[model samples]
Target: MIVAVASGKGGTGKTTVSANLARVFDAEVQLLDCDVEEPNAHLFLKGAGIEEEEICIPVPEVDEVLCDGCGECGAFCRFHAIVSFGAKPLVFPDMCHGCGGCAKVCPRKAIRETGHRIGVVGKIRADRVTLIQGRLDVGAPMAPPLIRAVKARMRKEVPAILDAPPGTSCPVIATIGGADFVLLVTEPTPFGLNDLGIAVDMVRDLRIPFGVAVNRVGAGDDRVHAYCRDQGIPILLEIPEDRAIAESYSRGELIVDSLPRYRPLFEELARGLFDGGSPSGNRAGYRPFKSCQGRFRRRENGCALELHGKTCCGLDNRCGKPPCEDKR
Candidate 1:
C-alpha cells in the first residue's frame, strides 16, 4: 500500500513518522519526499550515494527573426505566459504551464518548444528505504512537474510512503493523489486541530481513506480527540511531548534510532492503519499525555474544551474550522 504522510501545517512531525515507519517495515520500501520546497527525509535516512536526474519543463521559444509578431500566440495562452506588444512577444518561462497552446496558435510558425530546468530528482538507498526527493531550482514557481518526476520512481511491488508537502494546497494534492491511504499528522493544539479539519475535508473530497496521527500530544489540548470523535476520523497514533525526542531531532537523529523501543510503536501504527484487524492493545484509544496541563487553555469558562494557539471558529478567519468548533 502506498501511504502518504501529510499535514495542514508545518512542523507536525510528518517526516518523522514517515521515516520511522519506512525503517520498521520488513519489505523493501520507497520513501518519496514530494515536498520539493523543503525536503528533510534524506537527513534521517542517510545514503551512500544518490542518483540524480535533472527535471525540465517545456517553454515556448519564439524565433523572432522568422516572423512578424502576431498577437495570435498571446491570445491562445491562458496563463498569460506569452504576451505580445507591437513587434515583440515576451515569454515568461516561470509562468508557462507548457501547454504548447502558443505554438499551435502561432500563425507564423515561429514558436518552438524549449526546455527550462526546474529541478532535479535524486534517488538514494538506505538499508530498507529507497529515498526519492525532488529539489526545485531556486526561483522556480512550479512544483507539480518536479513532484511528478519524484513519483515516477515509485515501485509498486513494495509498500511506499510519500512525504507530502504541508498544507492542503495543490502540492499536497499532487503528492497524495493516488495513494492507498493518507495519514494526516497534527499536533494536539488548536492550530493543529484547525488545520487537521481542513486536511480531513480535502482528503474526504478526494475520496481517499485517511487517519490522524497526533504529534506532541502533551504539548496541547484534547480538542483534537473531540474533533476526531465527532468526525469519525481514526486516531492512529499519539506521540507525547518528550524532551529526549526533541533533542534527538535537533541533532538530525531519527526517533526510532535514538530510542530503539519506539520502533515497535511505529510498527504497530503501520499495522493498525494498513492491516484489516482492529487497532492493537499497544495502539489503544486516544488519551492525552499527563504532562499536557495548561498547554490547552480553556477558551471560555464552563467549557471543558480548550483552545491552543489558534481556534478555528469557521468565521472570516481562514483556519478552515470544522462545523463543530464554533458550536462548542
Candidate 2:
C-alpha cells in the first residue's frame, strides 16, 4: 500500500508526520519524498550508501534544415513554448511540458525532442526504510516531471509512503498519483481548517481514500475538529503542540527516537492507515461525500467556503479550468 502524507499549505508538519510514520511502521517500507522543490525528510531519516541518478524530461527542438514553419506547432502549443509568425519556430525548452505535441503537430517534421536535465533523484537505505528523494534543478521550469521520477523508483512490492509537497497543485497531484491512501496532516489553526478542506476536496475528486491527522492539536481552536466531525472525516491521530517535539525537530531527530512517549501515536497512525479504519474507534474508512464538494475561498476568518454544486473559487482553482463562478 502506498500512503501519501500531504497538506494544502506549507509549515503544517506534513513532513514531520511522514518521517515519524515511516520510523514506526511495523513492516518494511520505502519513503519517497516527492516534495522535489524542497525535500527535507532526509534531515530526520539519515543513512549511508547514498546513490544519485540524473532525471530529465523531453523538450522540443526545431531543426533549421527541415524548415517549414507553418505555425501549426506554435498554434498547437497551449503553453506557448513554441512561437512562430510564418517563420522558423522559436522553441523555449524551459517552458515546454514535454508532451511532444509540438513535434507531432509540426507539418514539416522539423521539430524533434531532446532530453533536458531537470533534477536528480537520490536513494539511501536508512535502517529499516529505503529513502528515495527527488531534488529539482535550480531554475527548472517544472516539478511534476521530477516528482514522477522519484515515484518511479518506488518498489511496488514494499509498502511505500510518499511525502507530498504542500498545496493542491500540479506538483502535489503528481506526487500523490496512484497512492492507495492519503493522510492529510494539518494543525488546529483556522488556516489549517481552510486548507484541510481544500486538500479534502482534492483527494475526494481523485476518488482516493483519506483521513485527517491534526498536529499541534492543543494550540488552535476546535474549528478543525468541528470541520472534521461535520464532514465525517476520521481523525486518525492527534499530536499535541509540545515544546520537546519542536526541540527534537530542530535538532533533526525523529520524534519516535528522541521521545518514546509519542511513538505509540505514530504507531497507531500506521495501524489505522493500513487497517482501513481507525483502530481507536473513531470513524474511518468513510469516503467523503461528493455532494459536499466545494471550492476553497479565503475568508477573513480563514474559514473554507464549501460552495455546494459550485465548481470553482477565484484564487484557489488549481484545476486549470474556467471558473463556474468568480466568488472571490
Candidate 3:
C-alpha cells in the first residue's frame, strides 16, 4: 500500500508526519521524499548512504547535417522550446517537456532526443527503512520528471510512504499519483484553511482516499477545526503546540523519537488508514469505503463501508472515478 503525506502549503509538518510514520513501520517500508525541489526529509531521517544515481530527461537535439530550414519543428512545438529561424532552430532546453512532437513532425528529420540532466535520485538506509529522496538540480524549473523517477523505485508489495512537496501543483500531483491514500497536513490558521481546501479538491479529483491532520492544533482558532467538522473530514491525529516539540524539530529529531509517548498516536493513524476506519474509532472523516465490486473483501470484519454512496470497483483505486465530494 502507498500512503502519501502532503500539505496545501509549506511548513505544515507534512514531512514531519511522513518520516515519523515510516519510522513506525517495519523494515519492509520505504520512505520516499518526493519534494525534489526542497527535499529535507533526509535531514530528519538521517539514513546511512546506500546508493546515488543521476536521473536525466530527453531534450531535443538538432542534427544540423540532416537539416533543412523547415518551420514544421517549430510550429509543432507546444512549449515554444524550439523556434526555427534562418536554417536553424533556437532550442530552449529548460522549457521542453520532451514530448518529441517536434522530431516526429520535422520533415527534414533534423531534431532528435538527447539526454538532459535535471536531478539525482539517492537511496539511504536507516535502521529498518530505506529512504529514497530526489533532489532537483539548482534552478531546474521542472520537477515532475524527477519525481516520476523517484516514484518508479517503489516496491509494489511493501508499504511505501511518500512525503510530497507542499501545495497541489504538478509536482505534488506527480508525487502523489497512484497512491492508495493521502494524508493532508495543515495548520489551524486562516492561510492554512484556505490552501487546505484547494489541496482537498485536488485529491478528490484524483479519486484517492484522503484525510486531514491539523498540526499546531491550539496555536490558531477553531475555524480550521470547525471547517473539518462541517466538511465531515475526520481529525486523524492532533499534535498540540509544545515548546519541546519545536525544539526537537529544530534539532532535526523525530517527534516519536523525542516523545516516545506519541508513538501510539502515529501507529493509530497508520492503522486507521490501512484498516478502513478512522484511527481510534473516530470514523467521521473520509472513510476507505471499498466497493464490494472491487478486489477488496466484502465482509464487515474485512471491509469498511461509508455513510456516503462511495464505492470502489477497481476502476481508479477506489471506483475508477472520483469518490469523495466536498460539500463545504
TM-score of model number 1:
0.81
Kindly give the stretch of ten consecutive residues in candidate 3 with the minimal lDDT sum: 299-308
Which residue pairs in model 3 clash with each other?
A: 234-285, 291-312, 312-318, 315-320, 316-320
lDDT of 2 by residue, 1-328 (tens): 7788999978999889999988886667788999999999999999984799999889988888896768899899998988998778888878888899988978788988899999999998898788999999999968999999899888777777899999999999998888878889998898999999999999999988877877876676767776776676755556777899999999999999999878866765665555422222212222221112222212111221222222122122233343344232
**Sort order, TM-score high to low:** 2, 3, 1
TM-score each candidate.
0.81, 0.83, 0.83
Residue-level lDDT of model 1, residues 1-328, one tens digit each, is 6789999988999999999877776667788999999989999998865689899989999897975887898888888999997687999999987778898888889999999999999998998779999999899988888898889888766667899999999899999998877889999888998999899999999998777888876687778877876676655665667788899888888888898756655766555444411222112211211111121111122121123223322111112223334444
Best by lDDT: 2
Give the TM-score comparing model 3 with the true structure, all chains together: 0.83
The residue ranges of model 1 lying beyond 4 angstroms of the native Cα positions read: 274-328
Q: Between which residue pairs do clashes occur in model 1?
A: none
Candidate 2, residue 130: how far the Cα is off, in Å: 0.7
Report residue 288 deviation for candidate 3 (angstroms).
5.9
**Which segments of candidate 2 are over 4 A away from where they belong?**
275-328
